[model samples]
Structures are given as structure tokens and as C-alpha cells.
Target: MLLAIDLQSETPIYTQISEAVIEGIAKGQLQKGEALPSVRTLAVDLGVNLHTVNKAYQLLKQGGYVQINRKQGVIIEPNAFPIADEAFKQRLWDRLKPAVAEGVCRGVKREEMMILLDEIYRDLNKM
Candidate 1:
């Protein structure tokens, strides 16, 4: 997977790594059952710490986006994708509310935000 990390950004490196993998999956660049680089390998490739990559992988595993195996290493979830349950919905809301609030505070209109969201959704789904 290709992860674009901005070291200077305020966002944490591990968060950026996990987000990139999630985006890759959404964009169909990473497929189900596909193996990801090992923690050490990815750390070397990205010139980040091994712990950073491992933290990202752990987050993905917790989110049900990937699975780690001793023999197989790390691979995309091979079975069903995670269902959008109530817990997920609440989590989504919690994560998005702050961003939406920031946009609102910046005087971004509802329509404008919707348009931007639609564009991003379409772009991610374009395979």
C-alpha cells in the first residue's frame, strides 16, 4: 500500500498511516486478502519508526480492516467487511461532528459541504 505521510502535519504519524490504508481500501487500491508490508519493512519504506507502523497496524486490526497472522503477516480482511452498526454510526458521528463544526464556524455553507462530501465519496468509489 502507498501511504503518503506528512511528517510536519499536526496529525499523528500512526493516524496518518491508518487513514491512508483505509483510503487505499476505499479506492480499491488495496483489495481483500492482499498482504500488507510487514511492520519493519513498512517502517523502513516510510522512514518512520517500527513502533509507528505497528501501532497503525494494530489500529487497523482493531477496526476490523485487517488481520495479522504469525505466518501470513498482515493482510486485508478476507471475509466480510464490517457492518455499519449503531456503534459505528455513533463513532462516525463523534468523529465528524468536530470537523463539521469547524466548517460551520468558518462560514462554509451546508450545500457547499454536501457538494464537497459528494465529490469525495464519488472519488473514493471510482474504481
Candidate 2:
């Protein structure tokens, strides 16, 4: 899988790296059980410090999107995607509330927001 980072972005490099991997998985570019590039190799390829790559991998692990093993390196989680629990729903709402509120403040109609959400859902499913 190919990963790209924007050196000039306000987001941290580690966050960009982890998000890229997550997007790759969602886009079906990286399959479950696939091994990611080694930390040192990826750092060299991205012209970043090895610690940055390692931090990204750690984030992926904490997010349950990947697993790291001494012998196997980093691999995508093999289990099915997690179902949203109550806690997860709460967290989702917490994240979405601000964006939805911003839309409301901008005079975005509910129907327009629904259509936009539907479009995003469809695009993700298409991948």
C-alpha cells in the first residue's frame, strides 16, 4: 500500500501516517492480515524519523486497527470491524455534534446534511 504525508500540514506527521493507514484499509488497498512496512523502512521512505512511524503504529494498535508482534511486525486486525457500543455511540456523537452544529450555524438544512451524509456513506461503501 502507498502512503503519503503532507509535510506542511498542521496535523502531526504521526497522525497523518495513522490516518493514511486507516483510509487505506477502508479503501480496500490494505487487506486484513497484511503487514505494514517496517518502522525504519517507512521512516526512510517518508523522510521522517523512525520514532514517528513507530508512534503511528502504536496509535493504530491502540485503535484496534492493527497488531504488532515481535516476529510478525505490524498487521491489520483480522477480526471483523467493531460494532458500535453505547460508549462508541457517545463518542461518535461527541465528535459529530460540533460539525453538525457548525452546519446548523451556517444555515445548512437538515435535508442537505442528510444528503451529504448519505453521499459520504455511499462513497465509503463503494471502496
Instruction: Estimate TM-scores for all models.
Output: 0.97, 0.85
- Model 2 misplaced stretches (Cα beyond 4 Å): none
* Tens-place lDDT digits, model 1, residues 2-65: 7789999999999999999999999999999999999999999999999999999999999999
Model 1 TM-score on a 0 to 1 scale: 0.97
**Residue-level lDDT tens digits of model 2 in 13-122:** 99999989988887788899999999989999999999999999999998889989989999999886676789879988998999999999999999999999998777
| Colliding pairs, model 2 | none
Which has the greatest TM-score?
Answer: 1
Candidate 1, residue 97: lDDT = 94
TM-score of 2: 0.85
Candidate topping lDDT: 1
lDDT (CA) for every model shown?
Answer: 0.96, 0.90
